[model samples]
Target: MSPARVGRVAVLAAALGALAGAGAGWWVDPGGDGTRPALPATAAAGRPSSFAGADASWRGASPGLDAAHAAPSDLAARRTGAPRGAVGTPELQALLRAPPSALRASLKTAMRHRDQGGWLYARALARQCVLLEMTTLHEGTAGLAPVDLNQPLAQRVSAWREQLAAGCAQLQPEELREAMNVPAAASGTSATPGTLDGADPLIQLMDRPAPPGSAAARERLAAILNRADPLMLSELGPALLQREGEAFVFDGRRLAGEDERRALEAATMLLPCALGLACDERDERVWGPCVMTGDCRHATREEAVLAATDADAGLDAGPAAPDRRAAVRAWVERLREAVLARDVDRFLRPPG
Candidate 1:
């Protein structure tokens, strides 16, 4: 076989292998039987989860569970300023315990690619911690009324900011880039046009912004995205570096290999939600009468960079509301159905 043919075979084999593993994993849902949930009657609607009442402090950058006691008074306090002799506080002690220490170590590893953006790293760390927090909160409040989403979000945000300031203050661009070994120059090289630039009927309808003066109406947009199932990027490995060719279909045309397809899908599935979350959280916590665009908000220079990429890529620029999370959740159920029914077509489409 030619090198291209070999490459194609390798890609197909890898995808099939991965699909098998994923299939097995889903089949053995340790938590519950692998029954997928039903889709809702109507897709959730509206602007990015309305910042008017959304919790700003719940963003991914807020300090992990440690921020509560690390700086009891001000979530922005430097690590050096933490209560020097009061390390005995239960929360502080808990933060020092093996679990949080393990979490910290895990963070260092996860942040190995820090140069991508400190804010990005910070946001990721905060999100993981919040998920942990939310999980714990749910367990603790089993059978309780609705969570005090506002308070937890505020506390999480405060803690996240403090932790980010303390942990990331010394991270200069060059040092971060060197640590991650991602060439700062290479970020400029990817040449694929974004999703909306193509001819997909669904995407085309999603290309434009929501109608004007719909800020309040669009508030739930972010939450809608947030509630979506997260895309597992590992599925696209074999296709990453392959050349775009007639065999590869993306947007509407045959592009290249799996890499671009994966990128396009991610932009379609995740970018918009990330942007909506960032915007909604920022509006709820930082600004007043904020518009949808980043320019109308108070993001730091770093966050501004992230926001711009999402907006410019048009990944996050879909119809103002699609219950993206719900879509993903429903997709998960469909996957379960496919696996049970042995439906090959349901499992083989280009992701998103």
Candidate 2:
């Protein structure tokens, strides 16, 4: 087979393998047997759980019950001014950015440190990785290819699965059991009745500020956006841009100023990719012609967006085809720059 054909075959195989693994309950229930009680419909809809109103102090509390008494690690001692549980350290960043081949070792290193929020951060990262892989598999099968032979992708899926299982094992039983007991009302989903599910841990954290208008809430939003991985961005960006009575809101307050407006526009353009990767796998806005034509040229969401024509409509509407594609490409570039710069402020600033 030609190299392109080989690539397509690999993707198809990976998708099948991933789907099979998911069916076997490896991906869906990595922590145990697939017998855990389903979260209430309200909770699944992103309503704040009954637990959302819990004391604000606990949200930022030391990770472990005895964490306060534990001596700081040499790494923690050296990083002055860093937040107690911050995950942005250079070492952790390196681990987060590590390739799949190196992921297991990186996860092991990340999971070893319980102080300074290392383990929590690691769990979040692992969970994100698993979700992203599942998204990739769905996209691959739905639009790109149709077969199960890719060893590398299968290995990656396996690695993330194992890491997630390891992370879950470290969680206290109560934490594991009660994490999703959040009530729909507390989720804010009860009030708005939107499709965005805030059940994901990172998304929950981003949306769970005690008093939504507080300075601490703003700081938390900025911190998470600044440090967010691509999957996190795909999930959180759209949630931040959610509309309420003629204005966009992040954490419930209307977006303020030109900077926030710019962020909203970027998030709007990001929706198709977000839908593909983090929201709805079956959304036609994400699938494009590949779903029908089976040509599968656009393997990635960026490619799909840039390849989109006026006929594709939706967000790609208004401007001429080339202009719309250019706009998306520009936003994609701006997003890349902001992520690389590691600054939410840069993300809000108008692109030069």
Candidate 3:
């Protein structure tokens, strides 16, 4: 086949395989957590052992998962019906977009290309077998209630590590060494330190189910999102509409100032409007539940203000304290006006 055809074939196969697994509730977790307690340790391998060791082994499993015939047959014979709403669909793709900040972007990218043969495998397996471990965690949490939107992002990171270790266990030392690129002197060192930049997407896809007839293609479909910054979801989704049901009123109209403008501009840089702002001691931090989502929101506002002031001051000592404080006070007033008016646009517009 032509190169283009070959590439299309790979994509098609990967999609089918992934879809099939989603339907069957099968995932590959590279972490050695044994997501499938009933299945044999080497079931994912699905073939004879190529090698074995504490940290590495190779099961000559067929890369072609044959989801069309195999997946449905196995799913039917299992006897246990799927959970209340267990129909498999492409859900992971929805999560590919970036979240709150650059850190989340970095993680999304890193997870996309993780080695499925390692820790990524375990995570996938666990998700596939249990189907609800992570899902439940997400749905169980309060706020941002999108079935599994509340899932702790930190837990996903932990699961990624687990998947990596488990997949690594099935490889031989030489294979592990080669996969991790560990030199003789650096036997125990991790080769993935900086390589995470390239591995994120692979990990993301692998963690999801492999589409039918595309196991081999899915395994080989390795495309790196080389861009330094991936797409941010906050920028793509619906705009944040204020729910306060009030408006800012100045002399004759709504009260608004440069501070409100700057604050709105700053809002774009933040996560869901659901994480509003709160007064933390003397500083304004992201709004949480207690002190503000007290846990997640930090001195983000203070930090931003400091950064803006420092940038404005340049090398100078900055204007007198009273002058700076006056500016902040004015900003506070504008913010109040903007919030009351629910002028999300004016709020986000940068102050001159």
Candidate 4:
């Protein structure tokens, strides 16, 4: 077989192996034979129940579960007068700009201290490290010819599986979102091609005057959000990333897991509405005014990213809703093409 053929086999084997890993992670009810409770998120996390630095007082980082303790909103989190100081700092900018492999050593460092825990940034960075590790599995396993057919594939597969299982053990869905910077909600889906070129929310937001002035606005928004929901925008990331995966399948590759598929549609809506990003004409269908897009709502509705009022009132997920899955699917296809084309500049911009 050619090297490409061998690599394809390795990737397939890795996916199947992950299924086994997933199954093993589920817990059997203590008394109920085959049933389990719906609320066992921690039990379902399938790794250590305790989050790293979960107990520590972290500084200058975006709020984690730990942030709920005092004030992630507290200015004291910073020493110098930086708004977020170290927390908001993109520690991985250098690595993200580098190849995917460069993340491995840093991931190892995060994983080692993941439990011992130190900085809130380290804990937050570890969450991204876990995700990066998952990507590397795909990148590393995507190609390779096993020199000896006699070698048990488990040797190659088990180690990586174990690593991912441990790293993501007790990983919450929200942590996944902030790491990717994918929106949990957006302001509108009616974004036209012309508007998206300049109207991408992040781009638009960046163009505004610097904070303290503008930052003061966000702080005010944060206070309103704390009253409305103290945990602001954490869960939004995972929902967006998962649903976006369905929209982003490429070269026959796709994302899976029931937890991932659940709430995909609602989360998809949030992208254009909450994040102020462009909607590909396709996603234009998957979300909109609640009356029209109600059918597109993910059935399970268990893992909500942002609350309904928050998504609608704050982010504006309600607007022209979908006619069919074809909408989001089409948008995803366009995104896949862009990524394959290495259109980094166009990632947040609406696809053609």
Q: Which is the leading candidate under TM-score?
A: 2
Per-residue accuracy of model 2 over 119-153 as CA lDDT, tens digit each: 43344344433333344445645323332324332
Output candidate 1 Cα RMSD. 22.3
TM-score of each: 0.26, 0.38, 0.20, 0.21
- Candidate No. with top lDDT: 2
Clashes per candidate, residues 3 or more apart or on different chains: 25, 11, 72, 21
Which 10 residues in a row give candidate 4 its minimum summed lDDT? Answer: 42-51
Per-residue CA lDDT of model 4 for 1-352, tens digit only, reads 6454344344334433422322211222333443221111111110101112111212222121111222122222323322121122222211111222222333333233221111222223333333333333434342222223233322322332343344443333333332223222321133421244223232222222323324443443232222221011122222212124345322233445332243233333332222111111111111111112122232111112222222323333444222222243343334323322434333232334
Model 4: residues >4 Å from true position, as ranges? Answer: 1-121, 124-159, 162-352
Preferred candidate (TM-score higher): 1 or 2: 2
Candidate 4, residue 275: how far the Cα is off, in Å: 10
Candidate 1 lDDT tens digits, 96-153: 2112323343244434323222222222333333322222233434332332324543
State model 1's lDDT: 0.28
Better of 2 and 4 by TM-score: 2
Candidate 1: Cα lDDT at 338: 32
Model 1 misses residue 104 by how many Å? Answer: 8.5
Local distance difference test values of all predictions, in order: 0.28, 0.36, 0.26, 0.26
Better of 1 and 3 by TM-score: 1
Which tens-of-lDDT digit does each residue in 1-352 have in candidate 3?
Answer: 6454344334333334333423222222223343211111111111101111101111211111112212112112332211111111112211211121111222223233233212222223222212222232233355432212233422332343233233322333332222222132222123422234334333333223324224432232221111101111122111222211233322223324544433333322222111121111111121111111113212233333333433434422455533553454444344334433444344222223
